[model samples]
Target chain A: MKAVGFKKHLMLEEEESLFNFEQAIPEATGHDLLIKIEAIAVNPIDVSVRLNGTETYETPKVLGWDACGIVVAAGSEVSLFEEDDLVFYAGAFDRPGSNAEYQLVDERLVGHAPHGIDIAEIAAMPLTSLTAWESLFEKMRLELEEPSLNQDKTILIINGAGGVGSIATQLAHLAGLHVIATASRPETIAWTKGHGADQTINHRRSMPKQLHELGYENVDYILGLNDIDGHWKEIAEMIKPNGRIVSITRNEQPLDLGLLKSKSAEFMWEWMYTKSYYQLPEMITQHEILEKIAALLEQGRIKSTANQIIDGINAETLKAAHALIETNSSIGKIVLCK
Target chain B: MKAVGFKKHLMLEEEESLFNFEQAIPEATGHDLLIKIEAIAVNPIDVSVRLNGTETYETPKVLGWDACGIVVAAGSEVSLFEEDDLVFYAGAFDRPGSNAEYQLVDERLVGHAPHGIDIAEIAAMPLTSLTAWESLFEKMRLELEEPSLNQDKTILIINGAGGVGSIATQLAHLAGLHVIATASRPETIAWTKGHGADQTINHRRSMPKQLHELGYENVDYILGLNDIDGHWKEIAEMIKPNGRIVSITRNEQPLDLGLLKSKSAEFMWEWMYTKSYYQLPEMITQHEILEKIAALLEQGRIKSTANQIIDGINAETLKAAHALIETNSSIGKIVLCK
Candidate 1:
């Protein structure tokens, strides 16, 4: 099988940062499904892992998470899908990635791909959608089926132009919340509003003042997508009494939790890889969430978030996609197809 | 009205720390109830306000919260209680406290007192029980009525012999979780066991090792009652993946939230006065919770946690009760009666 990989972590401009290589196809065992990769997505996590590693791997480390593929074979213990079924997933952190011709994944983390969508669209939906869904429905405890009950609630999504924010804004709106998302640039603000944001604020400006201008004293929930270090103070100030906040961003310094003490608010972290990395009992919920995402796509309630699609899934194309993701201002997902 | 209050912050042994003073009685208005105090419970908050303040008040500042009393009057907007009804409550932080001969409190924060319990016991329950119930059922999202469904879960209560821990352990036990409470002294351990702890660990020791020796790697939930800065690292390490931790203790330093990131855990602050202080819409829930607490007392499902009772509500008795509460290891609530 042909794979795109790196032996040592390096910048994308380096000659050996990523290379084409040959590796033997892994066997499917113990609920694993062997899938032939058709399309893959480049995320900020892909860029992070490629540049952050300190040790050289004995074998090349393939780095990709979001992919749309077809099941070529299944382990004896597999029960979810049969061979030839198309699937989409954000694979586990510890295993081999999907930037290859074929990959083996746990059936519990895979979902049947939604039809009537392009390969790039399907590939872009899994990772970000899973993260957005889990952060809102699971961590923040939003009522998915009871959207009517959420009519009076408000959610503020920071960095509304990012991958997770794109989906989160849509899902929060679908849950009947009044969505308030933040974006600095005009294009990004328009992009966020197109997704589902009822109102948009600029991250570069005074968010609290802008929020007051929009007639909200405080929000019931906040979903932080990036720059938690910079936005945390505003988040604390904007949350209502007994409100909840969920963040996927890393903080450079310690957060002062005292600001929320008098409000009796809640804080939660949402790491999409936690369930699969720890093999938690609720890991199967990933499959369930992805299935729901597919249904939403099929119903046309949410459109795919893929904005830039590149041809081919080689070292060259992945490096290009990585460069785009590193720019930090990409409006939507960047997908790579084989 | 006669009140035991302090004009300046001072040590408990100081003559001016708590003194008998006279002030005009406050009239009830807008959902307020004027109650004549019968008994009051001395909590650490009373000690805190007495010693932690820097500025002197024109009039002495009263520093009491928990009380069992008879309503002497009601405001036009009051709907929950009638005159002459015996009620128990932890009044708002910004109002005149229950240390006075007569105090005004919001009708929403007051609960109909339960019979069959002594005045001292009833006075000791309102503040601590409200903190415990809000932390467990509301913040942690535990199933309150579905006890059988919670049988498989486990909770750890730090400082199990303290006011909140004593009631939290009992409530968690009644909710059907296996309760592991922490108490260092032999007497406190015995008291905790009697309260509802299935097992006890010493918070002063290596808690993770003790928990492991008790045949558990981690707990599903943790309620922090005191010394959060000292117990934070252990609390983070001993919490299970996707767990919830609630604390009433103030942290002197910032907490390392990164420790719970990969595990996707939740942290919540449980300030019992938040709703009333903020005049939140859910303030009425306190009345409902107290009514339920009264029923539980009537049904003999939970017991009052008063450990010591002192005679009289004068400055001398209040000073003595405050001295006991200032001790680092008071086992249960201490009440002062008139």
Candidate 2:
């Protein structure tokens, strides 16, 4: 099987940063689906993993999380998927990823691809959609089934034009929350508003002041998608009493949790890979969330967040995607397809 | 009106630490109830407030929270209670406290006192009960209405013989959860078992090892009532994936929140005064919770946690109660009554 991987951590400009390699296709075991990769998306995690490690790998580390693929074979214990099924998934972190011709993924993490979406669009939806869905419904404990109860509630999404933020804005809106999203650039602001943000604030400025200017004293919830340490104080100031905040970014410095004592606020971290890494009992909920997202996509209720697509799934294309993400100005997802 | 108060923060042995004083009885305003005090309880917060501040008031500041009293008058906007109603309440933090002949409290924060309980028993309840209730059902997000669903769930309560812990152990047991409480001394262990702990462990030792020895690797919920900084590592290690933890104690040092990142667990602060301090829209829920608590008390579903009572509502009695709390070995609660 052909794969794009690296033996050592290096800058994107280096010749060996990401290189083509060959390996034997792994056989499916219990609950595993052998996937033939069709399309893949690059996220910030990929860049972080690529550049932050120093140890050279014994084998080239294949790195990609989001993928649209066709199942070539299914393990004996697999019940959710079969051969020839078109699926999408954010593969596990500890295993070989989807930047390959052939990969094995747990059936519980795989979802049926939406019928009307292109492969690139399907690839973009899996990782971000699952993150958005779980952050809102599970971590924040929103009642998606009771939109009426959520009608008066509000949510602030920091970095509204980013991959997960774009989907989160849509899901929060669909759940009947008044959405306030933060975006600095004019184009990004417009993009966020188009995707279901009722109002947009500039993250480059004081978010609390921006929210106050928009006539909101505080919000019922906040979904933080970028720069957690930078926006944490504003988030603390802008959350209502007893409000909940969920963040995807890891903080480099220690957070002053004492600031939230009087408000009795809840803080949760949503790492999309947590379930698969811990082998949690509810790992199958990812498949359920993605199925709902796929249905929503087919129904035209939510659009794909794929903003850019490259021609081929190879070392050069992946390197280009990584560079674009490193610039920190990409509005949405960037996908690579074969 | 006769009251016990302090002009400055001082050690308990000081003559001026708590002294008898005279003041004009305050009149009730909007939503306020002027109550004639019957009994009051001393909690850790009282000691915290007394010893942590340097400001000396021109007029001595009264300090007490949990009380069972008679409504001498009601404000014009108050609808929940009228004059002559017997009530139990944990008064607002910013208001003049219950260490007086007369005090004014918002009706929403007061509950109808249980008919079958003594004044000292009812006084011991309000503050600790409210804290325990909010920490479990609200902050931990437990489904208290569906006891059967919670049968398989387990909750670990640290420092289980203290004021809030005693009540929390009972509430968690009543919710059908398997309760594991920590207590070092023989009397405290017996007290916790009598209060509804299914099992007891010694918090004086490594809690994770104790829990593993008791045939448990992780818990579904954790209510932290003691030193959070000391127990944080054990809490992080002993919480199940996606579990919830609520704590009342503020951490003296910054916590390494990254420890729970892979488990995707939740951490929340449960300050009993938060709703009233912030004047949240859901402040009326306190009234509702206490009303239910009153009914439960009448039905004998849960018993009052009052362990000792001192006769007379005066400076010397309050000083004795405060001294008992400062010892940090007192089980349940200490109350003073006229």
Candidate 3:
């Protein structure tokens, strides 16, 4: 199968950074499902894993997490998916990712793709949806099924225009929380508000003052989507006593947790890769969440966040997508389709 | 009413460290409950409030939390208790404490005292019981009533022979988790095991190595009762993926939260005073918890953690008790009674 990857981590500008190659199609065994890639999505994790490496790979490492594909074969233990079943998934962190034509993904991680949406749109939803779902419901323990119970609750999504933030703002709003999301630019602010943010604050400005002007002393929960270390103090200040704070952003600096001690606050990290990286039993929940997200999309309760869909799944197309991601101003998801 | 307090924070040996003074008894209003002289329990917080200060108090600051006494009066808003009701409570942090002949506490923070327990025994329970309960069930989100569901879980309680630890060990045991508590001394080890610790590990040594030898890779939950800064690395290493860690022990230095990032772990602060300190509506949950604790005591499902009962709730007795706390070797709780 033809794939795009690199033998060594390098900058996108380099000649050997990402190049097309051919490899034998891997077999489906145990819980694995051999998938023929249909469309792929770009996320910050893809950029991080591509650049933040020192070791050289014996074989080129195919790098892509979010994808919607058709299963070509199923393993002996595969029960969730079958041959020719259209599926969506955020592939495991350690595995050869979805950039390849024939990729092997565990059946537990695959979910039935929504037939109502295009392949690129279905590909865009999995990674961000799973992250947003787990951040609010699993890590923060919000009651998603009982939206009425969350009527008085409030949540602040730190970066509301990004891939995960766009979805999180919508899900949190759907959960009946008074959503306060942050976006610096005019277009991004409108984008966040369109996605169900009740109020939008600028990440570049003083968020606490803006939050105060909106008549909330503190929010019941905080979902940190960008620059967690930079926003730590504000997050600590803006969280209500006994509030839960979940962050998917990686902190480059130290965070003072003592600020939350008197408030008895809860801090949870919702790394989407945790379940797959650890091979935890709850990995199957990703499939369940994707199924729910697909239903929500099909019902028109939520729309796909795929903003920029490029033609072709080749090395050149993925490189252009990665460059757009590097700009950090792109709203929602960027996907590549063939 | 006579109260033991100090105008300025000082060492225990100082003449002005603690002194007796008479003041007019306070009136019960709002949610206040006026409790007459009975018994007061000494905790580490008392020592902290007494010594960790620099400014001279206008009115000598009274310091005590746990108490069991007859409610001499009840406020207009008090529905949980009536006048002359015997109650146990851990009073709010900002209010005048229980180191007095009479103390006024919010009724929501007070619970009906168990008739089966001695006054000093009941006094020793409030602060410690509340801390342990909040740490285990509320902060850590452990299902206490449904113990069978927790059969596969394990908990590591750091400092298992101290006031809060003694109760926490029992509570975690009742919750059906395999309790591994830390105790270095032979007597402390025996005391921890007696309180239902399934295994005793030495905190002075490498906990993860010891844990490995005991047929466990990592604990599902960790209750950090002592030296959070000291055990932080090990706590980070020893917590299983998606584990919850609750700490009452304040970290003097900054703690790196990034260590738990890949595992997506949760860190919660279990400050028992948060609800009352913030005047949150859920302060009444403290009353409900204490009521449950009293029933547990009455049923012999749990026991009082009081180890020493000093006669007289006076300046001298409090000073002596505070001195014992400063030693950091005294196991269980120390109480003063009239």
Candidate 4:
């Protein structure tokens, strides 16, 4: 099987930063499904994993999470998927990722690809959609089914034009929340507003002041997608009493949790990989969430977030995607396809 | 009206620490209830307020939260109670407290006193019961009515024989959760067991090791009532993936919140005064909770946690109660009555 991988953590300009490699296709076992990769999406995590470490790997480390694929084989114990089924997933964190011709993924993490969608669209939906779905519905515990109850509630999404943010804005809007999203650039602000944000604020300025100008004293929830330490103070100040805040970013410094004591606010981390990493009993909920996302996509209720699609799934194409993500100005997502 | 108050923050032994003073009885206004005090309880907050500040008031500052009294008057906007109604409450933090012959409280923060219970019993309950109930059902979001769903879940309560802990243990048990409480002494252990702990661990030792020895690697919920900084690491290690933890104690040092990131665990602050302090719209829920608590007490589903009672509601009795609380070894609660 042909794969794109890197043996050393190096800058994108380096010749060996990412290169073509060959490996034997792994066999399906346990609840695994052998997926033949068709399309892949690149995220900020891929760029971080590529350039942030110093250790050289014994084997080239494949770095991709979101993929659209077709099952080639199923494990003996698998019941959810079988050979020739079309699927999409954000693969597990500890295992070999989807930047390869052949990969093995748990059946519980795989979802049926939405019918009639482009491969790049299907590829871009899994990782960000699952993250957005879980952060809004599960971690923040919002009532998606009771939109009437949620109509009066509000949510502030920090970094509204980013990959996960784009999808989260749509989901939060679909759930009937008054969505306030932060975007610094005019294009990004327009992009976010197009994707369901009812209002946009500039993250480069004081978010609390911006929110106040828009007439909200505090929001019912906040989904933090970037620069957690930098925006934490504003988030704490802008959350209503008994509000919830969920973040996917790691803080460089310890947070002053005492700021939230009087408000009795809640803090939660949404890794998205937590279930698979811990082998939690509810790991199959990933499949359920992706299925719902697929239905929404197929019905055209939520549009795809793939802003840029490259021509091929190879070292050069992946390197270009990573380079784009490192610039931190890309709207929505960038995908690489066969 | 005669009240127990202090002009300066002083040691309990000081003559001026808590002295008898005279003041005009306050009239009720807008949701306020003017209550004639009968019994009062002392907590660690009273001692901290007495000895941890340097500010002196022109008029003596009164500091008592837990009280059982008879309502002498009601404000124009008050709908919950009327004149001569027996009530119990943990008054708002910013208001003049219950250490007086007459005090004013918001009707939303007051509960109808349980029938047939001792005045001291009812006085010991309001502060600790409200804290315990809000921590479990509101902050941790545990379902109290669904015992069948909660029967298999487990909750670990640290410092289980303290005022809040004793009530939390009883509430968790009544909700059908398997309760694991921590106590350091034989008397405290016995008290916790009597209050409804299914098992007991020594918090003076390593809580994780004690839990492991008792055959639980993790708990579904944790209610931290003691030193959070000292017990944070253990609590992080002993919480199940996606579990919820609520804490009342303020951490002296910044916590490494990154520890719970991978498990997707939730951290909540449960200040019993949050509703009143923030004047949240849900403030009336305190009245609803206490009404339910009154019914539970009337039916003997849960017992009062008062362990020691003093004779009178004067300065000397309040000083004695404060001294006992400062010892930190007194089991359950201490109340003073006229």
Evaluate all candidate structures by whole-model CA lDDT and list the values in order.
Answer: 0.92, 0.93, 0.92, 0.92
Steric clash pairs (candidate 3): none
Stretches of candidate 4 exceeding 4 Å from the true structure: none
- Model 1 Cα lDDT, one tens digit per residue, A1-338: 99999999998889889999999999999999999999999899999899996999889999999999999999999999999999999989999998999999999999999989898999998999999999999999998778998999999999888899999989998999999999988899899999989999987888899999999999999999888889889999999999999999877799988889999999999999999998998989999999999999999999899999999999999999999999998988999999
Tens-place lDDT digits, model 2, residues A58-84: 899999999999999999999998789
Tens-place lDDT digits, model 4, residues A1-338: 99999999999999999999999999999999999999999999899888888899989999999999999998899998778989999979899999999999999988999999998999998989988998999989887778998999999999999999999999999899999999988899999999999999998899999988999899999999998899989999999999999999988899888888889999998888889999987999999998999999999989999999999999989989999999999999999998
Give the C-alpha miss distance for residue A1 in model 2, angstroms: 0.4
* All candidates: DockQ: 0.88, 0.83, 0.93, 0.88
List the candidate 2 regions with Cα displacement exceeding 4 Å. Answer: none
Second chain of candidate 4: TM-score?
0.98
> TM-scores, in order shown?
0.99, 0.98, 0.99, 0.98
Write the residue-wise lDDT of candidate 3 on B1-338 in tens digits: 88899999899999999999988899999889889959989999999988886899889888899999999988898888877899999989999999888899988898999986899899999999999999988888888889998999999999999999999999999999999999999999999999999999999999999999999999999999999999999999999999999999889998989999999999999999999999999999999999999999999999999999898888888989999999999999998989
Over A10-72, each residue of candidate 3 has an lDDT whose tens digit, in order, gives 999997788899999999999999999999999998888889879899899999999998999
Ten contiguous residues with the weakest lDDT in model 2 chain B: B137-146
Ten-residue region with minimum lDDT total, candidate 4 chain B = B139-148
The RMSD (Cα, Å) of candidate 3 is: 0.9
Q: Which whole-number lDDT from 0 to 100 does residue B45 have in model 3?
A: 94
Q: Is 2 or 3 the stronger prediction by lDDT?
A: 2
What is candidate 1's CA lDDT for residue B150? 91
Q: Which residue pairs show collisions in model 2? A: none
* Candidate 2 per-residue lDDT over residues B1-338, each given as its tens digit: 99999999999999999999999999899999999999999999999999989898999999999999999998899999978999999989998999999999999999999997898999999999999999999988787668998999999999999999999999999999999999999999999999999999988899999999999999999999999989889999999988998999998998878788888889999998989999987889999999989998999999999999999999999899999999999999999988
Which run of 10 residues does model 1 chain B get worst, by summed lDDT?
B320-329
- Please state the Cα-based DockQ of model 2 relative to the true two-chain complex: 0.83
What C-alpha lDDT, on a 0 to 100 scale, does residue B300 get in candidate 1?
93
Decoy 2 TM-score against native? 0.98
